[model samples]
Target: MRRSSDLSPEIAEEAAWWRDAVFYQVYVRSFADSNGDGVGDLEGIRSRLGYLELLGVDALWLTPFYRSPMADHGYDVADPRDVDPLFGDLAAFDRLVADAHEHNIRVTVDLVPNHSSDLHEWFQEALHAGPGSMERARYVFREGRGFDGSQPPNNWTSVFGGPAWTRVPDGQWYLHLFAPEQPDLNWEHPEVRADLEQTLRFWLDRGVDGFRIDVAHGMAKPEGLPDMDIRPQAPGVLSDDVHDPRFDNDGVHEIHRMIRKVLDGYPGTMAVGEIWVKDDERFAAYVRPDELHLGFNFRLVQAGFDADAVRSAIEHSLAAVAPTGTPATWTLSNHDVVRHVTRYGGGAPGEQRARAMTLVELALPGVIYLYNGEELGLPNVELPDWALQDPTWERSGHTERGRDGCRVPIPWEGTSPPFGFSTAVNTWLPQPNEWDHLTAEAQLEDPGSMLSLYREALEHRKSNAGFAGEELEWYGAPAGCFAFRRKGGGLICALNTSGASVPLPPGKVLLSSGPMDGDQLPPDTAVWLV
Candidate 1:
């Protein structure tokens, strides 16, 4: 195996870069506005590099900034080679990369290889040529009759809602596993694979360190268009049929192999995939050494505060990937889900739960991602129906309400209008009502705040060199309390998930999520001992 240090001084610095590394996920639209255009831009990110560096994170994962029409919030790329004009052009992006490197922070951009926007030049050319045309072959288009011409060619449904197939004016249908505006690429096509490889090469040549592939498992489907039975309760909801045989095919291995071939030429480059599988064995298949370097573990994000449940999730995830030589990436919150603080707590009690959970996540092996504004203990903002812009909510009958609450702009300054994110009179998304209370500026001044706790915890992890490569060992603890030890580091981490005090073992407390004197453990708190 080639080490990162073997390639170059820079590559060496990135090698094993993710081990014990902290990453901050920046949702481009809500980060910061450079041109006062009411939208965040690449230059805004460059301006904030010092802020991120001071926060103690090792890297930044900037969510899709590629050229797009803003459908699905930049996931629908119109061009892979250029940054969206709304977010700044290629020169601005290059400067952002340079600035991030100056801070010793690695940058990973979101790569949407599964699909492209309907407005993409390739998709436009394919539509004009129709079926059987060379350009049309790059996408999945089928011509056939269905039941009474009213039924779709297959029973597959779009992730947003309704049937996945949309009819063209030419009397044929093209498959789109996501929104209609985001068409799924035909990965089986050699031309499609070649084109995607070129896209990867485009960024690598420009000095990108890695990519975070979106909906990577959805890239392939069963060759035969199979029908899935409709469920009784939510008869039309798309995710109800998620487990259908046609959803994620085994042929994804071939796709991974192709991606691996492209990445092999660029040593030290990493790729992380967002796979939604629940089973550990199946999920681990996507993260073999020859495949993706890391895959997001969604089980931890969905698990409640039960100690048994979290213990099982950690054990299963570790066992599944340990043999494959693939590292795991853990995230509790992102732009796609409800904020962790809100999910864990509906009120003040939930805030305590969020702080406890944060400690547990930080102690886990591999890279940990902290969503923007998470350090400030921000809760989900309540957005009115009229203010919602997520397509998933519009198409899914509002059952899920999409992810609008969590995508609200981050509040940096307490007294500034629009929380100092934009100087424009009207920002894109409405600022949360409690911005003054939750702003980073306010939290930074409070010694007992979650933001300060996060800073102390992260600093402890960085200073303890023994914690990086140490093996994790589970220890017995009381109910609602999860305890684990890292043997090499002589460190023990205990998290209290309940609302009552728990007994503490003999050891000096290195850090605590709540008030701690010598040995008493507070309710809904966490303690790290050495």
Candidate 2:
């Protein structure tokens, strides 16, 4: 659309909001704790509306706050229709949505449809009901493999670790692709489909703008739940390299079509799927007109701090989504992975690379998701072993230290522990003392700080006409460096990934991720120009 003609940013945002919106991911429990209970709640998020508005995000993708057992930190849904007591009641959630909209920030919520908490009434009923009962049919329950019915139904393993099956007291086994406490829902079941539709209606009626579907690649298993010859992902990676029978099943498309039908009833609402398929044709299928409005392509997040790797990621991600006529989505970190700062190389150098990367990301053409505290240049906190809580940790027999580091409560404004996140001294995960210098309070006033750079970059991305483009054209650059111009707006974005500085592109400098070296872009730094 941008290449064809100029559309005011305001008009474009209204016409198709998800096309170019910047969404901030609020990982609920660690964002802000309102009642001083040491865990972030709905009220805490409502209180932070002003901060988010000031940060200039178009929407807030709040992670699940539904009635959960917290077994998977809210991903384990017990009651999808109501807010958990820990996060306050439905009234609190409604208030948060209303307040967020008042600040011009649309609210999207996480919807976990792949599985239900084992404590869910249906699952609990399935436990006691006979093997052939209708309740059992709502889940993927199957008979055991061996003669004694002692072995699991299949050799498949959980993404968290161990076997993907768990045995019941009745001697039958059920599939659980993650933790045993989370039982996979039988998407083929009419009751399950109806319930999910009702769920979409329930949340939409409550004013939720859209949904960020969890495990969007999962749900529909192939007929005769088969075995998967899987390769174990490396440590700290819940990686997706494709060719796993566990996910990205062809049957899953019909599920997305059903969800799309429900979402279509609400004109302004959208659904963005967290798909992990690597085949471009298969990945593109998830975003077809009758499917998800947006499907997250994580190629960029998996790339290292190298220019060639980053270039390849962008090109492939763009190509993957091109067939569907959907805009590409870009992100560097999320609640599940190690933060980009630490991944690039920890300490001052890491922060510099992160700042440079942020500029590069913001300059891109499609939807962008920012993990909370990323704007403040937060790095993964190496918490003591005693404090780790990710399910991956216990499931892997403590051999793997899961994602607790990136999920640490972000520092808001104080110089000590909790950092004004909560009035309580102890938090869900202890905050490191080193964060005294990285708190938002400490960075807001510093022009050179990461927060300030983010603010400046966001303002330009939102208001500057030069950023109006649906795609970018590559520009020739020196080795270990790459540059691109937004196809329509002529906005130039350049990154110097090499060890030596390079001359800036010929344009009016708009912003720099680091201090400029005369007329040059410094090593490991990025810049935006018009």
Question: Which candidate achieves the best lDDT against the true structure?
Answer: 2
User: Which consecutive 10 residues in model 1 have the weakest lDDT in total?
Assistant: 233-242
lDDT of 1 by residue, 344-398 (tens): 7657877887887788778777788889888888788888888788888877788
Clashes of 1: 3
Clashing pairs in 2: none
Residue 489, model 2: Cα distance from true site in angstroms: 0.2
Off-target runs (Cα >4 Å) in candidate 2 are 1-15
Reference-based lDDT, each prediction: 0.79, 0.90
Highest TM-score: give the candidate number: 2
Question: Per-prediction TM-score, please?
Answer: 0.94, 0.97
Tell me how far the alpha carbon of residue 326 in candidate 1 is from the true structure, in angstroms, after superposition.
Answer: 2.2
